[model samples]
Target: MKLTAASIATLPPRKLPYPDSLLPGLALYVGAKRRTWLLRYRSGGGKQVHDKIGYFIPNAPEGSESLGLAAAREKAREILGRVEAGVPVAEAPIHHPKTGGETVEQSLDKYEKYRTRQGGRIKSLPKTMKALRSALADYATLPVANFTRRDLRRAAEVIADRGSVHAASAFLRYAGPWLKWLVERELIETNFARDVSKPAAVKKRKRVLSDEEIRLVWTAAGSMEGVRRDAAKNYGRAVQLLMLTGQRLDEVISLKYGDILDGKWRLKGEHNKSGRDHVVTFSKTALKIIGTGEADQRVFPGVHGKISGFSRLKKDLDKLSATSGWRLHDLRRTLFTRLVEDLDFPEEIAHAVCNHKQQGLSAVYNQASRERQKAKAWEAWDDRLRVILATEKVVTLAKPLTGLN
Candidate 1:
């Protein structure tokens, strides 16, 4: 029988003999207190299922009423429409597993955060990310699995053509691991980075500063002017600190006032490039250069973080010193060279000052720390720098062994 308001009310609590003819699968479900409409049908998968449409009543009172025969038929028709379209229309929406969905940009962002959680230094990763994004701009929206070996080779070639073999190599170093991580998670079948060209060859830089260059840089640092004078001053001091301590640029810039204690700068393991704690004795001049800052605050504060505006400051330093073809890292090499050659400091003591890791059996057996010896060496280095700053005449020194010979 066709379902109608009059027919549905008189229907006893007994089970329906058959479904209504008006709507094929629509039926009035009689219960102890209330009546309800249930639509039963097979889905596209050929499995039978039932869905509750709405409550029914003999007489609808005022604004709220029972689900009438017309309403039940309409709702059933809508659900059947969804089923015919290959959707599983049930009481609740079905959730399916995501497949090949994440884009390259999305994966890269997630990988960056993962590295941070794993205690990896993210200082230089952004450059690599930016380069990759620019090179793979066409593939930003493509799924991570869609990236191919050809993509990696093309990106490396693009970066290398810009005249930085080191940056090209750095791109592979940063991107390769993240792609491998995706493979480990089963997001992709394989790492295309493995099939790409290996990191480009890099010529080790040997651009030590001469005494005349140091003197010129020291004077130039003090004489910075114009709108960016304050930024230049901070970068200049950081450069000088790199010269005095031979520490990594990031470690020196990230120094807090609390790191200074008992005439030593205590560098935490997480902040050091070697992933080990380091303590360096500061000279009187070094202390003066550091000056005073809030105990919990950065020793060299910048607009974004500690000590920025590096490229501009470096250009100015180069112009004033009449120098070319030197980077900030050369300052560290200059200090290590000066300690071993000019000051007659032992090679082992110099390595300790630079926090270089030992090799072979020496790494495990040699626990001998020459803190006092390293302190004296720093004092001697400070004395030498002061003498260079005091005079325009270039101080000549005996050529140091490059170890290449």
Candidate 2:
């Protein structure tokens, strides 16, 4: 039904929005204490946007702030015209109440508070906010309203140059939503970061460590010493555990004595990337390295919570090991590759041992735990690693063991 003044007056407060018959995108949001006018439309990038037009006042005099039904339709049309002309609703010359010229840094603080109020369930929120502040440090004092697309692009470029394309991409990925949040609150005129082009994709890394490199790393990790000797040794042990178990870096470091039972490391859903409980059988060597501990005790505690000073420790490891161009994650890829190629283990079993989620139809129907197969594969890989370490002479292969093409 077309919204008339009388009809709107009779309309009760509803949880769902009420659409206007005359205007396609115009709607009325009836709340218990107030009513609002909203204009819903799609952006040029196919993103759906609900632009708040204004509040509704039943019997306000002419030139009042609150818009009536007829006035709201007119306002919606005006906004729609600008939007259709390639201007974002945020960028349109609409008068919104100022947020007292909040600076980017202040806005960031507010955003953090907002996320905290929402329960802060996102594990990476803190890191993401830190990166944003670091990337946009130059604009910290600048008002959020003045932050532009060019500025956001420049920030991304700076991050890419200083770090990696991946880092820049991550910054943009977080910034876009944050800018949109500012726009939603009428604090900014536009979500300038939304349309900024991401840095060109970098080649995916496939670096897998060779047997000789693995031996070097193991030896170097064991020999690490400095002022923080105990912490360094703990980090080294954690690195070795990564090689042995093929688990993610975060999951391995987060290991507690309670997580290990009966020669198996049981990872809770929260700790696992797949958000499901996973069990990985431990080799005798891995168990020995883990040693004994109370159920509540951390196996490898660092100065704070878990291992820290990764960059310095990794640099030392690289120098001592005399190996370059490989990451800790490479150890996982190396294990999976060796299991499948050298031992002729089934890909499915290898995947299970790695705790990789299945793909396609297999993910939908294949609920088999494959625990027995995973255990067998783990034992075989453990034996292979022992052999690789025991050999005194490094067998020079005809081809380099960099990665599979």
Candidate 3:
């Protein structure tokens, strides 16, 4: 019978192979665990070979490891062509001795554990693993030994075609190091992903919202409405806090009332990107926005954890504020720039306010929080921001807007 996707879905598990009438030598075997596609053909040596093509999915999408009926047929034809030409073909279900017969997905699991033990960035591991999984989805079930440079290139191309060259490049960055680790452990003979050309480098964003743009965004965030009004308000408050404190978005959104004490917000090492405890003194305006909350409760409570749906929230915010080409991170950048450029605050104080990591000998010895200096900077910023928000006309400065300090 013709092997249709619907027919394949209902096929019962049996010891016998169900042959496909449409594709010569192509068959499906429905085992208790999985349905797999196979090609049965006679080799040049007159030996009958049962070549396993791949597993079968009723309707597998593009880039899936599992093959649909159409994809299976195509693979079967390719194998048969090689068989006819007397060319050697690698058998499916490859078991490499060095890798202990582990698949790509299995190796990735081991890699994650190894990296964690080696002191990999705790906060970034999940995101890196997630990107690698997505980029290598088509090869997840294949043995690590079977992965080739061609396969890495194909995976990157797939991601690039989907519209994010930056994501494609990032995939290579993550995968290359992991593949190299496999090589060092003798799991694979070579790092196949090492030489894959990445997409062009993305330009670093230098966008900083002007005072007028800041005011517009601040006003629009406060006046948000509709079904997601509460969530929107929470996100808006987080944005405003980012602008006020020059703190990272994740740090702001993940804030808990317990972290704040005596008008100073403290961030634990694990909760921040720097992996060092950070403390920032809050201005009166920032404190009012945070208000009073239970010690354990989140300042901006999300449905699950920290507030999400940022892309949608940002789109709505852009529409409402009449702002474009600016990111939430730009708020943090704007704060730092305004502090140093307009307010004449020293660069070191601005760095303290942003909790930027120091370098060289200073990084090892300097443990000072610089609380007094940071508080003074925040006070000056608060005054400047209030003036910007209150004015109806856009304030254009001919030179540095100094003297607030």
Candidate 4:
């Protein structure tokens, strides 16, 4: 029998059955606000399922005795008309996975697999997935089908409550792609977290160090204990290169012996965000840092257990920065700012040293392999660094290493 006003009133909150001829497939009653209702409907065999269609607001003429009841009837009639014509309807509203909910996790796993298989240069993939795992570890055992937006908001609150804006941002960012994917795949009804805003980027308020500050930091870092000492060595070399060559730390640290072909360091897509190869010519300081290592050797090798992480490295620097007063990355920025601000190095050559893939057609066509000019540029930089280091006597951090580690 067709679901009518009196019939719906007598029915329970959920699983209120309706006639297939009048409606279509199974209709399961969900929630309501007096007369308005949210329902679940499924089409075909078990292939297609939808959660919510539209609200059942009481469409009363003038006044009605039972507003909610009258509205339910009208809404039912409209939904039934659409179903009978075989139009697809919402099965459920897409929501954030609840505490102990795996809904978003499932979506994310599939997305990751697709991306990996597609062979994209996802250098940050591991970091992104690690954040997702950490955020949803507690909800791992929960069913994927029961995720809701309320749950997601609560999770974000919990993370923010713990005073971790960075962590919260990480979780939210990782969840975003998966949420969009679910919406596209019709996994949930709609993406509730789609409108969720992300945290603002940490400002790069830091600038390159002045000559006086550079001496102080170099002196302090070189005088420290253990890995920071070696990190200081790498730091020394990297700083000199940065000053001379003007490359970012990420691009410089990833440099290997093999990449140095005919006096050029070639950074592959695997090491960079830009899917193009970059060529950086080493300065005399950069070459000295290279120091006769095997072709595949890393320019800077951390000790047995020092994590290859910026945060970890930052903490180490913070402790030393008290005496040195120079933030670690400022070394790179110092090089950039000095070249651009003080020395007036061409912006193209400055960016080229960092292996920054420029934007638009210019980035593609204006690729100048200025290895000769770069070499000359870096030679000038080496002389500058030597003058600073010798004058300041800044290489005695910790016990003096007879040879580079």
Displacement of residue 293 (Cα, Å) in model 3 is 1.0
lDDT score for candidate 2 against the true structure: 0.78
What overall lDDT, based on C-alpha atoms, would model 3 receive against the true structure?
0.80
Q: After TM-score superposition, what is the CA distance of residue 307 in candidate 2 from its true location, in Å? A: 1.7
Best-to-worst lDDT order: 3, 2, 1, 4
lDDT of model 4 at position 223: 41
The TM-score of candidate 1 is: 0.67
Give all candidates' CA lDDT scores: 0.73, 0.78, 0.80, 0.56
Q: Report lDDT (Cα) of residue 235, candidate 1.
A: 70
Candidate 4 displacement at residue 8 in angstroms: 28
| lDDT string, candidate 1, 1-405, tens digits | 556657887777766633678778877787666577888889777888877777665533212224567777888899889888977564664222122478778888888778777875565666667766766665566566656566677667777888877777777777778888899978877877767765566888988988877876666655554343355567767777888888878778888888888678986656656545678999998898898777797876665576666786677666765666888888888898999999999898888888887788977787766788989989999999888877857633222112110
Model 3 per-residue lDDT tens digits across residues 44-73:
889998878887644333444557788889
Q: What TM-score would each prediction reach against the true structure?
A: 0.67, 0.66, 0.71, 0.61
Candidate 2 TM-score versus the reference: 0.66
Query: What does candidate 4's lDDT look like per residue over 1-405, in tens digits?
Result: 555654544444544534323444434353343322434454545444443433322222112122244444466666656666777654455332222334445766887887688776787787788877777665554444445565566566567778887678678877777667676877656777766554445454576566655665555444433444465356445544555666666666666666687667777756677566666666655666577677877666555322155554444444444434455556656665555665567876556555566798976787566655555555655666667667744432333333233
- Model 2, residue 240: displacement in angstroms? 0.9
Question: Candidate 2: misplaced stretches above 4 Å?
Answer: 1-103, 113-121, 141-146, 176-194, 227-229, 357-368, 394-405
In terms of TM-score, the best-performing candidate is 3
**Candidate 2 lDDT over residue span 210-296, tens digit each:** 878888887776666554437777887888888887888877888899988898887765555554567888888888889989998
The candidate, 2 or 3, that scores higher on TM-score is: 3
